[model samples]
Target: MRLEQALRSGRHLSTADPTEAELLIVNTCGFIDASKDESISVIRDLDSSRRKGQQLYVVGCLTEIAEAEVRATIPNVDATFGAEQWDAVAASVGPASANFDIPQPEFTNIKQPSAYLKISDGCDRPCTFCIIPTIKGAMHSDTVSRLIAEAKAHARDGTRELVLVAQDSTAYGEDQGDREGLATLLEQLSEAVPDLPWIRLMYAYPGRVTRLLAETMARLPNVVPYLDMPLQHASPSVLRRMKRPTVNKSRESINHIRKAIPDVVLRSTFIVGFPGETDSEFEELLTFIEEQRFDHIGAFTYSAQKGTPAATLLEQVPEAVKIERYGRLMELAQSISHDQNREMIGQEMKVLVESAEPTTSADGSPVVIGRTYRDAPEVDGLAFVKGEFKPGSMVDVRVEGALPYDLLCSPLDFHKP
Candidate 1:
C-alpha cells in the first residue's frame, strides 16, 4: 500500500528492490501460523540466492519467536533480530559495530500521515488466543522522555500523525515505573509534542481500558477520535475459557465515549469459532457487534498459534465452522459499514492525499487517489479523487460516494492555501 501510493508520486520508499539493491530485509509477523507461513515464503525466495552478492536480514516477531528454527533453516541470514534488535541491525549494517544508534527508525514507515512509533515491546495481557506474549515477550516500555523526544522528532520530520503501537498499548509502563501506563504516557506525549496533528492508539485491551483513558483522549486535541479497542469476543463463557480476564464492558465504554465525544470512532476486532465456543456464545458475539455498530470492525477465525493457552484447549472448532462464522461476522460488518459510509457521503472531510496512480479513467481522464484521517493507509480505505493532489498535502473534500473500504470524493481544492 505504501509503495503503490508513495512511489506513484515520485516518493522514495525503502522496501524490496531488484536483486541488485545494496540492502534487503524480510519483515515478518510471527504471531500466528498464517503470518509465519507468509514470512517463510518470502525468506525462501531469497534463501537460494546465496551466490548472488546481497546483504539480507530478517527482523520482527519471528526473529525472537522461532529464532532457533529460523537460524537452522535460513543460515544465510546476515542478521536476525526482533523489536529489541534494532540497534544490533543498525550496527551490522553500518560502521558502528556496536551500540549503533540513529535518530530515525531504519525500517520504512508504510503508512501516510500517521507513522507507527513502536513505543513499547511485548504483551502483558494473558489473552489465551494470542501468541504475542510468547513471541514478543512481556511488556517493556520505552521511557516517557524518549517517547516524547521521538514524537517531537517525528513532528519536525514532517510526520503529521503518530501511531502509538505495542502488543498491549495500554500496558506500556507497567513493567517500568510508577508514572507509567499507556493512558498517562499518552497525556505526556501529547503535551511533549503538541504540534503533531494526530496521535492514534492501537492494540488496546478491553479490560485495561480505564475511564481515565477516555478522558485523556477526549482532553487531548491531537489524539485522534479513533481507537482500536480490540474486544476479541463478547461472550463471557468464551472469554473465560479463552483466559481473557476482561469483563465485557462494551456498553459502558461505548456509552462513556459517546457521552464525552459523540463523534469518536471505535474500531474493534473479534475472533469467531474459538475453542469450546458454542451457538449461544456465537449469538452473543453477533449481538455485541449489532449493539456496537462500530465505525471499524475486524474479525478473524480461530487460528492456532503455538504456545498460546487456547491452542491446547479442548473442543477445537472445525475449519468449516470457523469459516462460516467468519463469513457471517464479515457480512454483518459490511452492512453496517455501508450505512456508515452512506452517512458520510455528503460531509466535507479532511483527507491526507496519499499518492497518484497512473491509470486511465472510464472516459480516459487521469485520476489520483488518497485517504482521509479516518481511513488508515492500507487496511482501511481510500479517497479516489480525480484532481491534482500532492502526496502528504492535507486537503478537504466532499464525500461523493462510499464502498465497504474505499470512499469516492471530489476535492475542495480551494480549501487549501
Candidate 2:
C-alpha cells in the first residue's frame, strides 16, 4: 500500500535519510502492542526532530484501530488516515512530492527476475485469534480483469516470476457471484500471460483448496506446483475454538491435493500455543505434525491479539510454556526438513537462477545462486551452485548436498533433454 501510494502520488521518498525531505509520511502496521509502540515512537521522533521543510502524515491499520488516540497523542502529525482513507492520503501530496521506481521486496531470488502482485485484500476468516477480519473488514477480492492487467504490466517490466499474495488467496471471487472461482482465475491467468514462465500462489487457506482448485494447479504449466496453506492449528477441538473447519476435513483436503498433484510442495504454518490449550491437546498437534512432514513448515507461538476472542479466554498458555512448545516444534521441523531434503540428493531439478555469488580469494569459484519452484522468495530456503550458470538464467541442477533449509549443488553443463 505504501509503494502504491507513492507511485500514484508521483513522489520519491527515502528510508535512508529523511532530514532533507519536505513531506514525511510513515505507514504503520500497528497490529500488536509492540508495533503500536514502535509507530508511536516513530511519530514522536518525527515530531521532535522538527526538521526544516518536513511534514508528516500517518496512515494504516494503526489509524483504523486508534484513530482518535493517534491524532491526540501525536498532534505533530499533519494528518491521519485510516485503512479506507487512501483518497485522503493521495490528496495530501502536492506537485512537489516525487516518485521512484519501486521494485517489490524480494529477499532471495531477487535477481530482478521475480515480482509480487497482491491479487486481493482483507480476509473473511472468523478465527478467534486473528484480527484481519476486524481491521481490514470482510472479503474484498480484486477483479480478475484487474489482476490480469497488473500481471501483464509486470510481465512487460521483465518479470519472469510472479507471486500472488492476499490475506486469503483461496477466498478469491467470493464477493461476486458472476466471477468464476479461483480455479477459473488461475486458468485465465495462465492464458493471459503465456510467455511469463512462472506464477505462484501464497497464503491460500487449506480448507479452500477444493479438488478442482488442486486440479487447476496441476493443469496450469506456468503455475508452480506449490501450496502455502496456513492451518493455524490442527486439533479438532482447538480448531473449533479458533473457528476453523474440522481437522478431518483439512486432512482430507491435504490428501486430495497430494493425490492430485504428486509433486506438489506443501508449505504450512502452525501456532504452537493458543488460549485454553492443554498439554494433551498440544501433544495431539505434535503427533499430527509428525505424521504430516510438510515440505516447508513454519511455527509461531501464540500471542495475545487485543481485540481477538482468543485473548479473553481463560487458561491462557504461559509465555514460558509457549516458548518451550515452540522450540520443540522447530526442533522437530528441522530434523524432518533435513530428511526431506536428503531425499532430493542427486536428483536433477529445475532452478531459476536469481543471483551471482562472487568468488573471493578464499572462496573456490563463482556460482549462480537461485531457487527451485518449492522455495518462495525470502520466506523459504535457497539453492547455491558453483559453475557456468548465469544469474537470471534457468539451469539444470543436480542436488549434491542438502541441509535442513539450504540446498547446495553444481550445475549440469552437458545434460540435455
Candidate 3:
C-alpha cells in the first residue's frame, strides 16, 4: 500500500514484465528462510532478464533485515530501502508528476470483490521463530478515525467486502492503552459502510481475543463468523519454547470463540518440526487437530530463519523429518476439511463472485467462479458457481457437492448491485 501511494505521484506506470519497464520495484518478503530464498531468486531472475536501461530497486522486510548484504550480493540493484523507508524510496524514484493527485488510501488497480485494510503494522509479541517484530518494529495502529475513513473510501470504490488485517488484530488499541480498540473500530466501520456485505478479521492473536471482541462479531450483521488465529503448535512444551500461549490457554480461547459464535468457521495455521519438537509433541498436535476439528487448517514445515533465536537452538529437526510431519499433518487436515465441507452439501450460502471463466456445466451451461463466507481471498478454498455473473456480484448458491478444499455450488439467485 505504501508503495502504491508513493508511486501515485509518478508518471511511470506498473508493468508485469521487468524488461518492458524503465524501473522495477520488487517488494520482498523475508519472514522465513524459504521466503528469503524466493526473494533472492526473483531479484536474480529480474536482474538477468532486464534490459540495459531498466533500473532495479529492492524494498520491504528483506531490505530491512539485510540491506547491506543485498547491495553486496545483488550489485545490479540501483538502490535498497528498509521496510519503513517509504519517503526515502519516493525520493530515490523522483517526485510525482505535477498533474497527479493523491489517491484514496483504499483505492487500488486490482479488481476483486474484496479489499484488505491494514489497521496496524508491526508486532510486539516475542514469538521466537518470527522475524516480523524485528523487521517491522513495535506495534502501531492506525487511528479508528483513519481506519473508518479508509473503509468508507473502499465502500465508495465498490468494494463489497473488507478484510481487516494486522500483525495481531486482536491486539489493536493496546499500544494506545485502549482494550476495546478493535471492537470500537468494527462498530464504526459497520455504521460507516453498511453497503459492504462482508467484514472479515485476520491474524488475531489467540491470547488477545477478548470476550467483547467475540461478542461484537456475534452482534454485527456484516462481520463474518470466521476467525484466523495462527496457533503455531498444540504442545505446551513447544508453545513455551516459541513464546506463545500455552496449549490449555489456547484451547480455552478457542472454546470461548466457538461458544460466542457457534457456527464460526475456525481457521488456523500450525508449524511442524520446530527445534526440539519430539515425536510425542507431534502426536499431541495431531490429536489436537482431530479433537478441534477446525474448519480449515494450514500446516507448514518450520523454517529456521537466520536472525531468529530458533535458528541457534539445539536439536533442530532434520529436513526429512520436517517434510514427513508436514505431509502427515496436511493429510489429517484434509480429511477433517472434507468432512466439514460434506456436511454443508444441502445448505444455501452467499458467495461473492471473484472470477468467471467460460466453461460448460453438467447441463451444458456456463458458470462463474467465486467464494463463500467460509473462504478468505487467496489463502482459502473457492466455490465454483454454476451461473452467468460478473466478477464482484454476490449470489446465493445451493451447495451441490464438496471437495476437500473447495465447494461445488449451483446458483439459486444472483444479487448483482
Instruction: Specify the highest-TM-score model's number.
Output: 3
RMSD of each: 5.4, 4.7, 2.9
TM-score of every candidate relative to the true structure: 0.85, 0.84, 0.92
Indicate which candidate wins on lDDT.
3
Candidates 2 and 3 compared by lDDT, better number: 3
lDDT values of the candidates? 0.74, 0.79, 0.86
**TM-score rank order:** 3, 1, 2
Model 2 RMSD in Å is 4.7
- 23-85: candidate 2 lDDT, tens digit per residue: 677787766565678899998888788676578888888888787888899876888877766
Off by over 4 Å in 2: 1-6, 9-26, 30-58, 66-80, 97-111, 178-180, 356-364, 387-391, 414-417
Query: Cα lDDT for residue 174, model 2?
Result: 85
lDDT score of model 2? 0.79
Lowest lDDT sum, 10 consecutive residues, model 2, at 102-111
For model 1, the run of ten residues with the poorest summed lDDT: 1-10
Which tens-of-lDDT digit does each residue in 65-116 have in candidate 1? 7888888887778778774565555555654223433333423334445677
